[model samples]
Target: MEATLPAVAEELLREIKKAFQETSHVPDELLLALKFIFGSSAVAALDLVDQHSVSRVVSPSGRAVYQVLGSSGKVYTCYAACHFCTCPAFAFSVLRKNDSLLCKHLLAVYLSQAAGVCQELSVSDQHLASILLEEEEG
Candidate 1:
C-alpha cells in the first residue's frame, strides 16, 4: 500500500497550494523540495512565475487552458488535465525521448497554479474555442 510517485507529487502540490493560500509564497523548504523533484525545470518554472508569464484562460462554461510565454516571446499552450504542453521541449524531451517529466512551460503552469500567481482571464466559449483552434493550427 505504498503511495506512488505521482501520488506523492500530487500531495506535495496540494500542500504547496495550501501554503500559497496562507502566505502568498512557497516556503523555502517546499521550494527546495520542488527543485529536488523537478531539477532544472523547477528553476525555469519559478523564473516564469516570477516574470508573470503564466496565465489561466477560462470560459463561462468552465472550460479552461493554461498558457506560458517563453523567454523567446513565444506563447505555449498547456493542458493541465493531460499534462500536455505544445512546446518543442515537451515534444522532444517529455514525449519523444522521455528525458524529462515536463517541459518548462508545463512546469510553469503547475507552479503558477500552486502559487496562485497565474493571470486569470475569462473569455467567451467561442473565443476559447478560437484560441484552441489557433494553437492547434499553429
Candidate 2:
C-alpha cells in the first residue's frame, strides 16, 4: 500500500502534465483532480503559472537553471530535475516534516514547463554563477 501511493501520484502528475501540453490549459476536471491531490499548493502553483512567473535560465555551456517568482514576491531557485526548491515551505513541509512532496514554486516550474510558457533567458556562465550565489532574504 505504501509503495503504491507514490506510483499513483506519479501517474497522476504525468497525466496532468500531458493534459497541459495538449491543451495549454488545464480543464476543469483536471483542476478539480489537482485540488484533491495537492490541496492549496495546486491553487498557488496555478496562480504562479497564470502570472508567468517561472523562468528558465540557461548558460552558454548548456547548463540550465529554473526560477520561480513566488506569490510572496520572493524569487525562489528551483532544481526541477533534482526535486529541490529554495523556499520556506520546501524546507519546512517537504524536508524537515515530510508532509508534502513539493513546494508551490517547484510545482509552478513544472507546470510552466509543461505548458511551454516559461520565460527563457540565455546568459553567460558567470552570470549563472552569480544567480546561484545570490542570497535569498527571508
For each of the candidates, give the backbone clash count. 0, 0
Q: Can you give the TM-score per candidate against the true fold?
A: 0.88, 0.87
lDDT of 2 by residue, 60-101 (tens): 999888989888888888887778888889999989999887
The sequence of per-residue lDDT tens digits that candidate 1 reaches over residues 7-27 is 666777788899999988889
Candidate 2 to native Cα RMSD, angstroms: 3.8
Instruction: Show model 2 residue runs off by greater than 4 Å.
Output: 1-5, 135-138
Per-residue lDDT for 68 in model 2?
Answer: 92
Residue-level error in angstroms, candidate 2, position 85: 0.6
Return the number of clashes found in candidate 2.
0
lDDT for 73 (candidate 1): 98
lDDT of each: 0.87, 0.83
